[model samples]
Target: MSTAAAELRSQRFAAAVPDLERIEAMPLLAEIDALKRARNAVVLAHNYQAPAIYHGVADFTGDSLALAQQAARSEADVIVVAGVQFMAETAKLLNPTRMVLISSLAAGCSLAESISAADVRALRRRHPGVPVVSYVNTSAAVKAESDICCTSANALRIVESLGVPKVIFLPDRYLGHHVQQ
Candidate 1:
């Protein structure tokens, strides 16, 4: 690697995980970069992903909505999501024609696990006629059940945009509380 690239890698590791050895990451990063180019893929990483993946290999990195928007806008034939399962599913939902893959199939999140489509269906049963605004942190099934999708940044706007007195916001208690407030 060039001196500048090495320095940048070291800085990224330092910023994300201070104890991570820079030398331990070079080979992996090289392989990942080569794979991305070979597959004509763009890596979209979430802000919470490892710094090496986020800053080193990812073509785009940001919060959930930003990553989803980027995935939707990407022209790449393949998309690699370097976050949790829900993120990968979101990318696939947006880019139906693109090949979307997650870095790890086992990766999951608390927010994603907290709710299900059955739960959402029950909510619909209870609230008859109320629109459901699902947070993007949810699973594809949950999102499919939603009337619309919203990110934490736009939850309130989405709820209000429905032009209804109430909307069922799911999966994320913190974001739901914030939106309610």
Candidate 2:
């Protein structure tokens, strides 16, 4: 890393974590940076990630939509997502040619788990011609079943963009309610 980049990273870590925690994390952060360079990898962290991972190791950090956008634009040989499984899956979907990895197999979303591809198919059967608008939090299978996918930030716009009077919003009732309101 350049001196300026290192300084900036240090500043970010300092701002995000206590001095003692930052000190303890320095070695692991350095290792992560070294591995990233050796493997030609980029770390994409979600908004919900720990401050240490987000500020210390993440090459790019944002919401799921932004992370997917970054993943699509990334030229790195390997993409590491310090987020949930759905976000990692989104990255893989956006960059099918690249190797995408998540930190943990257990890092999952309850909202995404609440519905499945079968559920989406059932909704389609029940609603007939109504379009399926899946939240980005859904699994890749659910997304594939849907007509379009959207993030919380863009749900209202995406739903409106469909030019349909009625649509089925998946999984998260709260987000769907927010979109409806």
Candidate 3:
């Protein structure tokens, strides 16, 4: 590494020293690591997670879609999601055969909460042949009810690809509206 890069790395480590010290003071970080090894699990944390969880225990940390993609591609027997419930569900959706666990069941996202599986089912019943597209922010159950799943970045193409004049897009009204436009 260049001298400047080395100095920057040192500075970054120095800045994180306090947080690292706190993590080291407890057995949580060590236990989590040990558990990962024992269970052959890969922990995927979102960018919004706590620094300790993100920097300390997470094997991969990124956005929801990125984390889900990583979890889908991971060779581990188990996957741990250190974000909201929907994120864990997303991982499970992608890796249906793998064991997916959430760091905390209490963690939730407002967008995910906006729709439920029953609601999607009801929409399908009403629409009959119209395709249902679910945003990735939704729960796995919701995704299962839909014809396809899409991310914010690919919402337009996903919607258009269905080749339907009218399709149901759930959870995020704004995104659905954008796709409609």
Candidate 4:
């Protein structure tokens, strides 16, 4: 094996290799890449992924929020998120016009569990025309209704982007306070 492959194999994971190998598609990774290029889709993987899946992606890598923005700006007509559910949702939220698919639908976020569109609607009703700035950890339904989205890394910038002196931050309260700070 090459040195990089060896290093990846040595890394620890919660699932056993045999468990993943029963219907392994690693063999088709090259073919999948070729197919994606033919179809003009960009594949995104996250920073926390298993090395095999991470390295096999087509175009880019980052934290969930960054990958979402990448999907939004991509020239490709389709986006395949080789990551988790929340990541896929974020991508779809940003790329509402583009086709977005997930490698696995079971992946999710408990923090993302914190808010809903009804909540945003109610909040917007109370605030009344105040801009809603949703954290990127939210569901696409929530994001679709938001005026703008922000990552922890860029929350302040996003808030400032609205050119408004005040905004309502959502889903991740700590991120709200962090950005306010």
Candidate 5:
């Protein structure tokens, strides 16, 4: 990493430390506790989520997959994921019997949008019978419509594991381009 970027990150850490200490000494957490009980819901937040939302509201927090896995294991009737649409869809895909809600559908992800089911189907037509390996960052409708799901960290493994000569990866042109290389 560049020194500038490293310095900027260090500055961010320095800026956040004082506020974190203050929050730790406050009664805000108590209020959030009451809200959680009243809502009868559990928040599975992403690491990228705002500190107030992540630390204040989230009962379980982690990366996209980790939070989704937690949601699947949680007993809460209402699961509110303070992340993007794909993350929420992942929760729905896992816990199909439960209710899942995204804090903001507009909070989109480039990787998730890289491919759609329709795009996959269209590509399939072009390739005749080649398999389509979609990233888990897709809608359930897209997932249900897919051959299988994989993550960015596991994209190549899924490709090699599937043993398909032709592959059509979607929605995120960037992720697709990255995987192709």
Candidate 6:
């Protein structure tokens, strides 16, 4: 990294961290920067990530939908997602040619785990001809089974755009309800 860019990264980390933690985080942050440069990788952080990850090393940070959009548009050789598995999966789906990595294997989401591709297939069988509009929170398999994918922000619009009278929204019942309303 250039001197100016390194200084800017340090400033961001310093602003995001408490004075006591800044010293401890410096080495790790430096390591991450080195790895990013070596791999030509971009880090995408979710809104719920810690400030250090969000503002310190993340090249881009936003909600799931925005991160997905960023992943689709990214020219980086590798993408590191500081979010749940589904988010990483979405990034991979969007950028099939890029190497996508998750920060932690243990990271999971209850909403994404709530349904499976098999469940979606069954739903399709039960409600034939009804288009399935899956939330972006679903796994890649579930998304593949879905007729279309929509984020919470665009669920209603996507459903309406389909021009279908009824659509099956998956995983998040609350978001489905909100879209229905």
Q: Which candidate is the best by TM-score?
A: 6
Ranking by lDDT: 2, 6, 1, 3, 4, 5
lDDT of 4 by residue, 30-127 (tens): 56767776888777888877665665443677888678778878878889887778788777767788889998788777777688888899999999
lDDT of each: 0.84, 0.90, 0.83, 0.75, 0.74, 0.89
Cα error, candidate 5, residue 153 (Å): 2.8
* lDDT, candidate 5, at 175: 70
lDDT of 5 by residue, 101-126 (tens): 88897998876676666877777788
- Considering every candidate listed, which one attains the maximal lDDT? 2
Model 3: per-residue lDDT, tens digit, 56-157? 667778999999889878989999999999898778877889999998989999999989999998988888999999999988789888899999999999
Please tell me which model should have the higher TM-score, number 1 or number 5: 1
Q: How does candidate 1 score on lDDT?
A: 0.84
- Candidate 4, residue 134: Cα displacement in angstroms equals 1.0
Estimated TM-score per prediction? 0.85, 0.91, 0.84, 0.69, 0.75, 0.91
Model 4 local distance difference test score: 0.75
Task: Compute the lDDT of residue 173 as modeled in candidate 3.
Answer: 93
- Alpha carbon RMSD to native, model 2: 1.8
In model 2, the runs with Cα more than 4 Å from the true position are 1-3
Candidate 4 vs candidate 6, lDDT winner: 6
Q: Candidate 2 clashing pairs?
A: none
